[model samples]
Target chain A: MSGKEALLEVDGLKKHFKVNQGWIASLMESFGSGEPDYVHAVDGVSFELREGETLGLAGESGCGKTTTGMSLVKLHEPTAGDIIYDDQRLSEATDAEIKKFRQNAQMIFQDPFESLNPRMTVYDTVAEPLRIHDIPNETARVQRALEFAELLPAEHYFDQYPHELSGGQRQRVAIARALVLDPDFIVADEPVSMLDVSLRAGVLSLLDRMTDEFGLSVVYISHDLSLLRHMCDRLAIMYMGKIVEKGPTDQIIENPQHPYTQALINAVPVPDPGVGRDRVELQGEVGDVIDIPTGCRFKNRCSEYIGDVCDQVVPPLEQKTEFEQDVACHLYESAAGYDPYEEMSGSPSAAETGDGAESTPADD
Target chain B: MSQLEVEDLEVYYETEEGPAQAVDGVSFELEEGENLGIVGESGCGKTTLAKAIIGILPDAGYINNGSINFKGDDLTEMSGPERRRLKWEEISMIAQSAMNSLDPVYTIREQIVEAIETHRPGTGRVESDEIVTEMFELVGLDPERADDYPHQFSGGMRQRAMIAMALALEPSLMLADEPTTALDVIMQDQILKRMGSIQEEINSSMLVITHDVSVVAETCDRVIVMYAGKIAEEGPVEEIFNRPYHPYTIGLKRAFPNIRKSSQDLLSIAGYPPELVDPPQGCRFAARCPMATDKCREEEPEAHYENGLRSYCHYADEIDTELRPYADDSDTWSQTAAATDGGVEE
Candidate 1:
């Protein structure tokens, strides 16, 4: 349905925000020439959305996937980067062009319970999009969207407010609002993360069908790997405001090149009891995003850190020989000087917990 | 004797509409040093059950019936002070979120030491410090960061601190309510696995409650499936996962996507669980059950034994082997949902 055309091309995207400084500190900044603090929410990310492809931004919490997803919809304007959609540059577009872009792209927020307006009924919630865009036949378009979103029969829900609807129903209504304008693209941030497991599948299948039928490009952002596997064709693994790896979903999961991606894949709890994975426990918490790391963002928690080069030189996103996915790590780079895994490195204490605890069942 | 036992437990919240029966006639037991898990989704009364056991029910809530026994003593019948005396000394609980559980005003050390001192009164400062350090080591936390405030620690560390506080007294019974729910997957694996090791070291009975099936399957010895304030199935973890007899358990197991498997369409349960307010007199899951017969909607099934497992289904033996295969398809559930709509539609 997409005809393999590039709909949105994002290059070197960066989003940074100034940290709140105390009044005294702000006064001191006038005299002191020290650099003011800034949180690099999204340092640099590059990706392309084919006309109808689903690109999954996968990572743990605070990894900046949400910020990147919100940026495309102009929720968090990028401090530096180029955003070109449908051959039109979005970063420096005219007022009319930006307005048109907003119409074509819409966002489905994370929490269904909080995202919807408490006072608005289903009709008002879905119809608001049409009204804002000044679209004709508001009733017909809203009704069609409600039906397309699988809020079946449509009329019963039109009179009901968000509080009356269940979590699944509320999520469906949110989707309808996004689709009311017949948008060409969607940025869904953890669309089903808040819903129950039973309801998750229903909402996912709805999104899947809508994307396929409408030929819509989607930036589906989620920390859940399983959901991404089911929903997306390609995935970009983020770490501290950077896409450390990006490739086909299957290839990335099957043979993840980056250490962080490998850890994430291994960490996903398998539902079955029979399957056993050699668990990799990260050493400590994620580093403070405010104090971004110099080199690879994941190096502090990385198990197989190469050497001083890992601390000195930042690794570019490079495709290694063994993996089909692109990776940014010194281990894959030959210029890193040496392989640490080949030598003795792991602390006996960390290894003791990693190996001994998994096999030794708690019960006698 | 079992370490912990609950029989005919019923808890109700006094709401404006009426008393919301959150936990209704739920019965289960945990053996000495055994790990048990209560699995359910939102509004299934797992946490209410925990609060009942901990004797921490809110002002508006009360236990209408049944007894919670901790080592032969009826906890429900005990006086307020008697129950308070047993709080961390005999039984301990790791609350849902570690960050919220810890007081932000105090250091982690102060909070832990205070808990230890409150129950066990008057351990010398040096001894208390040593014990705190040992507890930190047991949970893989560095003892040097003991003086750091709650904000200084990570999510996993705060959880570990909470565990250290809970385990400070080495209680015979430990209850962890969604201990790893909010943590990242990597952090969850380590924390849970570390908890298993700690449980083994302490040799304490554990009751873990969570919405994730995998958490129970991997950690607990026995599992109980709950729906609409009633037990759906109860058995050993392996048996329950491999051969689920209850329709609710079958639907739940199939709903979650397997990480190892190829990308296939997920099978979701069609309808939500029944509301507890004036719940109907029938199988709580009958409305959503795929093979729900007319009898299922009319009569509540008792726990019937099948190969040592207990299933609350009239046709447990019949559905055990048959419904397992059909549960993979979403259509099977949707069709039944459509078929049983007109009667007790609420």
Candidate 2:
């Protein structure tokens, strides 16, 4: 997976939203030397999407998966960091370069119901992208894209409005619109989450075909591990505006290093009833991105909280295992010798469970 | 006798076009302390069936023909006040959308106390507060935060509060409509785990309606697969997961990608469900069933029983030999369009 050329590179990407303080509150805050509040949605996140690779961006809601995807597509402009596509820096790109980048990369939104215009016909929706790019041969391109989406004949659906199509068909129209530009990559944010289970497979298979046949790099964002496992070649797990762990799909799912990743995987309800997974009880819900603590954001809910170290130092994502994945946690000290974490002990729950690794903590 | 016996349940919604047959000729029994899950896609009438049982269907919707016998008393036959009296005390529902269900103005404790006091007016504030605390504890919410408004709590917390409210009076039968649909995987798991423990403690029968089959696979004891507002199959959860006799059940099972397995090809049931207002005069699943024949398109299948598993399909008895061979293949399902076209009279 690493051998392929990088299609899109996101480095230290940060997107923050200002919490609106009323005039009275703003005046009160101005009187004091207090910092203005900002929801640190996507903070210090970095990842690379190789050509022809399908990378799954997975996290619970508000964990910045959607924010990161939006940032990549310039839907949400980043406050910090950089997004480079096809060797051109997006932030510093010329108008022409940016326009070309837009044609190169597209986004398939989560909800098909709201994504497409109700008034626009299927042909018009698919043709809009081509018209915007000022690409010629609009008639042939739109029909071909629809055919590629398996909307069968494409002409049959030319006049049908979004309201006329089913959830699956509407999504296919969304897909055709995304693929009409013939982009190098597309960011699909929970593309099938709204569709029925029966229809999800069809849409997903179309995405699979896009990557395999067209060699299109895709950043597939979803909360479902099951769907991600089937679709993604590599998986990146996010928590509270940062990539906690990212590795090969199988490696991450089978042997997750981060406590948050473990809990997330264990929590997924397996379809097979016979295989009973012991519940990993983490204390609280996801912490607020606003006024985030100095150290690990996940420490409050992390079962494997290893004392003050987790609360004191922000962990950097690095190669924790022999595998290609990188994990961000205080437990896996990147230094060769003199582990500071070895001295401090974990909480009672961590010691009792002690399934994370052999080197976590031992009773003397 | 069973705790809740629903017989020949036929529910319809008065639409602009005509009466939409949301639930048609569905019958099932929920025994004491049994966890029955109704799994299907949107428009399958699982939610409508739940709403009907709980007697909270929308204004347009009504029970066309059915008998909802709860505790030897038919719920459909009861008057407005009589049914209202029975709600929180005996039967409760955990609505699909937790946020919408909880009133934003009232505090969690106040809302719960109101339900308790309304059902049993003699209960004092202190007693009701104690019940609220106990219920909150059972649902894993901090009892101290009971005074907080619905907006003060997170999505998961609000859902827990909803669960706490539903279990406040300790209803004999609990109806949870997609309890964890809006929640994330971790929150969903925690909520489900909490519900399971609470059910064990209270010994209540729960009817869980969800579009996700995996939720049913874990939480439910018996499962009913609904298609086009009709029962396509009914059996134990394990049997439904392992050996689904109905073609719809088979297709539905294959649709879900298992977390345990790697790179499994997900096969979708091609084509949309028939229009509910005027569904075809045959098996509702015939259009999408790969094993569907001309006989299937002409007539509705009778329920075939095999070791407690009841399947509504022509080849239910010979499912293993005939349908199983072609079920897993995506191509088999894709060809269903052509097969159905051949059967359709133009």
Which prediction has the highest lDDT against the true structure?
A: 2
Among all candidates shown, the one with the greatest DockQ: 2
Q: Which residue pairs in model 1 clash with each other? A: none
Q: After superposition, how far is residue B320 of candidate 1 from its true place, in Å?
A: 2.3
Candidate 2 scores an iRMS of: 3.0
Segments in model 2 whose C-alpha atoms lie over 4 Å from true places: A1-3, A27-33, A321-323, A335-364, B337-346
lDDT of 2 by residue, A1-364 (tens): 3348888899888888888888988898889967677888888888999999999999999999998998888888788789988777899999999889889889999899999999999999999989998999999999899989988767888998988887888899999999999998999999999998888888998999999889999999999999999999999999998899998999999988898999999999988878899789878888888877756788888878887777755676877534557888878756434343443353433433222221221111
Tens digits of lDDT, candidate 1, A330-356: 677433343423222444343323222
Highest TM-score, which number?
A: 2
Pairs with backbone N, CA or C atoms under 3 Å apart (clashes), candidate 2: none
